[model samples]
Target: MASSPLNEGLISFLATHAPNDAFAETDPVKASQTLFPSTTYTDAERAEISQWVITSSHVGSPSEDAAKSAERLSSLNTHLSSRTTVLGAKPSVADIALYQKLAPVVSNWSPEERTGEQGYHHIVRHVDFVQNSPLFGLKLADKVNIDVDNVIFKIKPIDAKAEKERKKKEKEAAAAASAAASGTATPTTLTGEPAPEGKKGKKEKAKGAAQAAGEAVASIATGKPTAAPEDAQTKKKEKKEKQPKPQKPAPVEKPLSPALIDLRVGHILKAERHPNADSLFVSTIACGDPAGTDNTSEYEGQVVRTVCSGLNGLVPLEEMQNRKIVAVCNLKPVTMRGIKSAAMVLAASPRVVEGEDSHKGPVELVNPPTDAKAGDRVYFEGWEGEPEAVLNPKKKIWESIQPGFTTTDSLEVGFDVEAVPQLSGEGADKKTGVGKLKTAAGLCTVTTLKGATVR
Candidate 1:
């Protein structure tokens, strides 16, 4: 009731008409409590007006709820009929408040265009009337003529010190250019072109001639040629090649530490099709917090997480319940089709191909060992670490390591590749290539299925 738009409109109207009245207050912070009195919705007109304040500048599309709100407003508009305002023969706050919300739409539509829409006729008329009314303090043409596309507003001023520093850089560049010209030096130029041959070039040539003359005289007096012009340029080229190329350090697998992954054995407590998404299944999984902390307030000690998985067509609904699976517990939560997924269930499937649903083949579950309990941590043989408190969804941590996630010919799940460990080798000496999945966690298996990738 406090958020009722009808009450808000009524307050605005009253405020304009009776500036001194207590109920006419308009300051948001001051009138918050008073604007929507307990009886705001008791009035039929106010309640109907409240329903019309549906859309806002922020909302782009009308959701299902928004559609219902529009319908409610239409019904009220029909009841108001030919009235200039929402409630009666006179303009009121309800008209002003509602006009503001629908102004964008109404001002854009022609009168005939408004009638073409089911509910716009009354709303457009109301907007036209409000803008013309004195209560708004402006005429309709003036108010509706705002140039939204050309809007301009002052931005924050630059910091004084920053402005000063920027000016200093400009002055320094100018001074340097002046000094280069005055010193007759062929200043270092960024264009990679020699400085224009002017006075500077003539000076340099004359200086070179004097040096050459001195060198020749000394060579003649010593009965030895000035050391043959050095092959300095050639030596430089050779030196560059001799400098060993910087070997690219082998790509280190910065996998989310096992601790960061919070991989735990979990049982699907229940599974159901998500109401809002056709390809997703909403499941309740039971897995303890990897950090081993009590999460009773949020998890309620049920050790349960709701996961939304795209397993609808591949995994049968009935087969999902009570199935033992591995869950990544530290991945950031995501809202899919309005359902908040708290964890992700790990599965193995053929590498995903764009625009192709792999559900056509077996999207197998990476199951937990038969004897493993729900809280048991899943770890690879050589890689040891814990799940980070929260996984960064945006960072490609999972994407970086996902290629390594693989199944052996025996259907074992692990990081199915190898390379010379980073610490064991140097630059070009480093070795890397395909290797075996190095996990000691007992393979999760189904008694009936064999030699299949767990996806």
Candidate 2:
């Protein structure tokens, strides 16, 4: 097929944009300096150049006359809209090539002002169409998209089954060829020697005669002949005594449990310093649904729950804000400083050299690398399950009676609310019935009389 005018125009545009430097001679560094001249081109100038390249390439041969070229460019713009799907599907190489050629033109179509109305509209429509199409139709790999200047270019996936079948056939063919070659190879005798050939002169004749005499004598004497060569006997013995083939070890089975997987990636929703403790801060972290949708009801499909710990003593308050960290999220709660603490943040302790001053012990708060984001799950070595919670010893709660009473208490009960009369005789006073317990005739009774005045 003949090369499209668009292709030719693109090539020309690239050549101009990436011009060779005459002053640099062969040095790329010096050539770049001379070619670029300035640090950057103004947006307006760049857009104008891009538009010219796009129109000229797509519109075909530019006439010597300015008016003719302009007319051709307008006609080409109209033709592209009517013919090409533009950005309806994924951006093709053609689209990218055209975009690169006309970068300046597209850039010039700023949100603030629109120039080259027809051309600009065509580019916008093309981009919109591409973005809205099925990602697979564009042949894009899973979770991967090509982005250029905030524009996404998608490609559909290749046929996996077809690819697998092609690979399987290739492998089978290779195996057959290998087997055929192996089958044609010569087989070794029991004695590890080549089979005897037909008689070839005196030495073979003498050997055959001796073997026949020996076999005849053995058959006549014992009805069993030992015609086999001495070496053959030795070879047979050696083969019999050969060690048995070794068997492959069975694969070790692993338990399939969440405790076996790691679920550390999540976002920090809220953080608060402990009121009574200077070295502790309570943080509420949300490990969003791993399946990508909030479907679980326990935590609104949140994979991880809140964890409270003493981070202020180890990490700076400012650094903790909006930061993602891998933490153990499934830990039993413990109490610290009369407050229930939940979950523990995973931070690497700094290595300290021997003989370091105990008072000035160097401790460093481990931070996740920049590539890691909030809600990114991490795994620990040898651990089988996902991290369900952070380790916080202070978040533990003990079983109690009376809402907060221990089993040792004689009166095992729950919270009892009672209303007391107000001084104004308008509202009732709220109080616990435990304080108003009365013991009479070996019986205990707790009662509350609403609106009753005790003066």
Candidate 3:
């Protein structure tokens, strides 16, 4: 059977995208055992570059190790001489791998370093060539597109040394715990070894027997059982009385007000990767006709909004497809990576762990109830507002409002309304002694996911 043309096409595609291994053999014989040696070798090279170069260095702060990483890369690029791309005369998987790794660090470099004053002229040229390459299908001339300088490349490795140390500590802890359980040493004893049972035990036994004999004699003399020594009885009584009694705590109450901003239930109609940004998704959301839709204006009755979300690495595409979600409807539309985003999706995720993937955990969408239709107003019990046509980013309205947007005890996403004195002097009859807010009204949330954080 003959190989299809797809074999060469695939080779070229992988060469440009996937790249070679991070630690492949530079030797031609060992490298050529596989078809696409460039891809294998380059992939290995990227892994080494990411681990040694990016992971070891702190972002925004260039350390000694970072300088060393840069120097190593410079030397390797210098070896490439006047070559146009990585591996050979044309671009290969190796070029893509190296380009992606170097671009982030180099883009953040000072002007002098970028211009080859740092002796990385070859690296600078390669980065520029790859950035301008047409293979990624990005229209990068647009200012809103992703800027490589802002990217932080993180690679997490389960360190063997750290793991070994953890195990050693665990073993030591277990041994200490076992010794404690067996009462290997008593608190009162001065010696390192366990106190001898013969000396202490014999002395206590002899003293107790003498006391008992003395008591018996006294009882016979008195013609009745003698009472315990007053001091000893008092001490025992006091000891029993000194124990603490557990107390239940009083309940705490929170004040409430109406929701501050406009939130709506939205359904994701379509989701696709942004052409110009690696970590962004261009999505179309169906929110139904908003409150003020009329025949005269485009903003009026607009049921669908285009949103640009940074859920690329955080959420799986399959999870996002046709899912019901919560959205901030009034945020001012902005151009992101050349795409106009009209709304913002709401999601919840755990705090990021350093050196680990930020998207490693589950990213749950803030979903609305099935009964809540699209475009239905999401507001607090006591607050009310017609949705703003456009919120100002410069004023930071969203930032101010964001902190208060959270899930209630009922698991519904709503505003954390403030408590104010009732104007009618009906505070005495109110449940909260002032104004109280309901747990769920028009908010977007799911009953089953109660107490989940909505970010």
Candidate 4:
């Protein structure tokens, strides 16, 4: 059977994603379909594109607000998260149509904006896959510079059964909440406290006299009060005294070293300017915590933390792209510009000479070995030990040790024992050496700064 003539959007899509000898300049889509008939759709894949997801997506229309554009991009990101192409596993013309629309915008996205905290990760991944995959054979000169290894978030493979159940529960909860709000459905576990007025007193009644003192309930049951109150009081006091108090666990005393800082290799998935602060850039970073860890959240299946750093002006936003660096994960999470920052990214710059502005330019992130995976343990060479779970803010441990954090002439980060006297054991306990910051992969280094204090 003869197929219908290809639409204008499909013609343009073919020109970009799958251009070849099959395409006829006069009637490209029709000509391409005649030669490479695989472009044919069996009603399974829709052949539509011009009607943009957001009118602004096709071209950044001045009339469209930024919020709508963002909303559309977010929706597209989510849609592509599970599928390789717009038509699931199939390479359809729609994939190219999306690429044509999105390529320009993604090409311009700053690292902090794309993956910084899950902003447009799936979309970026989709674009990368469509552009490079052998199935597409798309040859575009102005391709987005994507480093697959420097991914912001590595989405874990989804468990079909678990996800299905989770979604089912979520839907049930939503429905229950809706019913309760409209005053239609009765109370449910999902609808926390919206029980019918008649059922309210049942909870108290079930407890009955048992909720009263056991002795009172016993006396009341028999309609007799012949127990001595003094005897009961003496027995209760005796039992209380005999029960041993829980022993307070002794505090874990770690040596005053960078090891207490809980440093680890972190990969910034995405970064963006903090909503509440101009000088702070908020980043979504993966540092290898298990799912549901405190102050940690899931992004693309990766357990990630929202980190706020003062690298907005000091470090170029473009450089913040999904890159590996050193991070202090055990520090107490703090709210920066209304965002809870779970980790601190370590960057280096020339030491501030007291009166100089510390927020000056040329800040470089501490570079972990390129082969180092996120969450790899990083510590000062000679100071290697099990790091504390979290640094105690009251101990001022981080503050005391930070002064000794310095970069050597060779660009390597190290802990100078002389800078922090507390770490320099004297006499028999004479511990003196510059411990370089490193992971099993290699030593961490900065770009140019040497003999500079690091924080």
Candidate 5:
């Protein structure tokens, strides 16, 4: 039902080599007559030719048929050369027809002469006869016109001057129509106007009169003038008079004494598990920009820097290499399990049920949120900073400095506590009190205090 590759190749070969007479039944009897014409050869020669054609048709099978086909093919080649012109001589229709039929067979010949000088010479002679001979040329020309409908040769030159004049006339007509619709004139029109000032002034006056008359008629019909009513005018004046005096500009808001650290997207270049910590990995991250160094003094030749994080607790070390991730590069360094962890990797976790295989289990996936990346400055909506202060602040406070005054007993309260005093004399009056002050935690807890609430 389907054509095999060999068949398709054969068909393509035949179509190209014998394009003029591609169809098997191109002239039926005429084709058959050309290859085995009755008048040209004797009955014995015709019978031999018929046997040769039969043999060539069955050449694919390696039997007596193939041997016969080979012999017949050779006979056909000799017969063609003997009957028709060869080398550089004139060619006949029979020569063209025979050439097309034999070209496919000749293509399969040994490389020594398959497509060598002899074949080349035969083709050149045929092409020359088709091109130059009047009868063959007429047939080819007619076929070309029927198929392509265009001349191949550039026999005549185009009239450039006439073409330019035609295009110029069309452009001028378009310009005139455009100018008339726009109420403008071509440059040449201004020179043609007699009494230019008088004509222009009259036109302007006529336009103004027409607009005024239209407004007047509208006002009369609607019983309301197009201009503001007297009441509206009075109201506007009264409102302007009642307007408040402009207040002085508020004092310039100072920039907060804090830094806003940026979280940027970066690609991982290298990754290694922490020597002692199985849950953490040390990864070298490259943020792509050479100017985005966190520590300018320490990192000189490095386009990428190493940061130890708890990624091994999540993703495997092998999977982390060459992966893109979002990281908080400006966080203050802290030693985790004897390894220095410089930044945090942001990830999202999905809930997983128990008994699920670990490979198929739900795990947190790390991704850059909202097109964010490493070395990109993340900010609190209304906060200003050097990014690092926001990322790693030393302290955070929300104390109300102004205290309330009460009419009760005098209580000497320490900064640590605000409760009523239960003692008197030296115990209550002691200003030098020693209290344990807790150290401020890192940026995470401070950020949690300032607007980053867990839901």
Candidate 6:
């Protein structure tokens, strides 16, 4: 109802992006419809966006307590820790309202106040992200300068698998304590039956058997022919022996994580159109394999993989030559047309909607940091678990995890854990987060595509 920077930013964005609409509108709830008019949202998202728009107005209000404002800021930071925008991966008018209010406040904060070990670092990151990210379409020339590398504290991301295990152990321990309190936790033997308390105990049974053995020995030594006792001993020994049981085949090992895919930084040595296949490109890539590796040969004295990617028409041939890239190195070798491909090049393309062609153009090859040498390890953050030497195709290990591969709003490649339902744990253990793909050098990224699928 009153003039404010938050309201102005929202109106200005609506005017620029949707100028045909009424720029004089003052109601934030009504103005939101014009910001992204074509972007239809679910009922839940509409409700959330409306709530956030109102919440944005309270951040710098004169009546708001400083403590309350700090608490709210902290909550926003935590919410954005695992997400690129307030609506997780989706953009909305809420982000613009929030950015207008906080960006100015963030610009005035000192280094210690913005990125100190105990500062609102995530909030600062979000502010910088909004302005630079193309999703918002804000290209201000005097944008606040942010140093992403000057992070004062690196927060360890929440580990969903470890958290799931911790909760399971707590639940089991609580059940055990409850059973003990009821006084019904029966003592049991190794075979899962109630222990015999009044019968011949283990010690007594052993003594009786020893006595029988000694008596038999005396009878034999004294030349007393005890036919019944000898026959009884024979029957007892026979009773203890039985046919060997068949061993159960070893349990099939489930693929534990995305780390099972052996991702590596690779440098292409040569690239050419496939002689037999019109849509494929054959590339010789150096991926740090040891000499004499199977399906590998020497190229310029470096062990290289013959990788065939279906990028002939998607990515230019010049871009594929002598460039650093990320690749899946552990897949089973498959012959493409007439050439054997030992690895698959990683790339990013827009997600295919229900009716759209999945193989249309605009695919971008994933670029590893320039300093990253061929064969350097690349993995999703918080998922640095060791990779399989050679992925088992029968298990479909790569297929199960590849769906989680995605590009961030900032063009960084990452893996969204919730996309893989099987690995996302059960009920309360369910999780959601994006682990950015990285090597020791830096993050893997695309040229310009945002929110695309990386495979």
The models' CA-based lDDT, in order, is 0.52, 0.38, 0.50, 0.68, 0.38, 0.74
- Considering lDDT, where higher is better, how would the candidates rank from best to worst? 6, 4, 1, 3, 5, 2
Which consecutive 10 residues in model 6 have the weakest lDDT in total?
A: 227-236
The residue ranges of model 3 lying beyond 4 angstroms of the native Cα positions read 1-260, 290-303, 351-361, 408-410, 417-443, 446-453
lDDT of 2 at 375: 45
Off by over 4 Å in 2: 1-263, 289-304, 351-361, 369-373, 380-455
Point to the candidate with the largest lDDT.
Answer: 6
TM-score (all chains, Cα) for each model? 0.38, 0.25, 0.34, 0.49, 0.26, 0.46
Candidate 6 similarity to native, TM-score: 0.46
Q: Which ranges of candidate 5 are over 4 A from the true structure?
A: 1-259, 288-302, 350-363, 369-386, 389-393, 396-455
Superposed by TM-score, candidate 6 places the C-alpha of residue 108 at a distance from the truth, in angstroms, of: 69
Clashing pairs in 6: none
lDDT of 3 by residue, 315-385 (tens): 78777777777777777778898888878888865444478765654666776765554554555555554
Q: What's the number of clashes in each of the models? A: 16, 49, 24, 6, 12, 0
What TM-score does candidate 5 reach? 0.26
Best of the candidates, TM-score: 4
Output the worst ten-in-a-row residue range by lDDT, candidate 4.
47-56
Report the Cα lDDT for residue 210, model 2.
47
* Residues 276-332, model 6: lDDT tens digits: 998999999988776446788755435689999999889999988878899899999
lDDT per residue as tens, model 5, 297-409 = 11212245567765575566787776666565666667777756556554433223577533332233333333333344432222334443223244321112101101111
Clashing pairs in model 4, backbone N/Cα/C closer than 3 A = 112-271, 115-270, 116-270, 116-271, 152-269, 155-300
lDDT-wise, the better of 2 and 6 is 6
Please give the lDDT score at residue 128 for candidate 4.
Answer: 84
| Residue 400 lDDT (model 4) | 90
lDDT of 1: 0.52
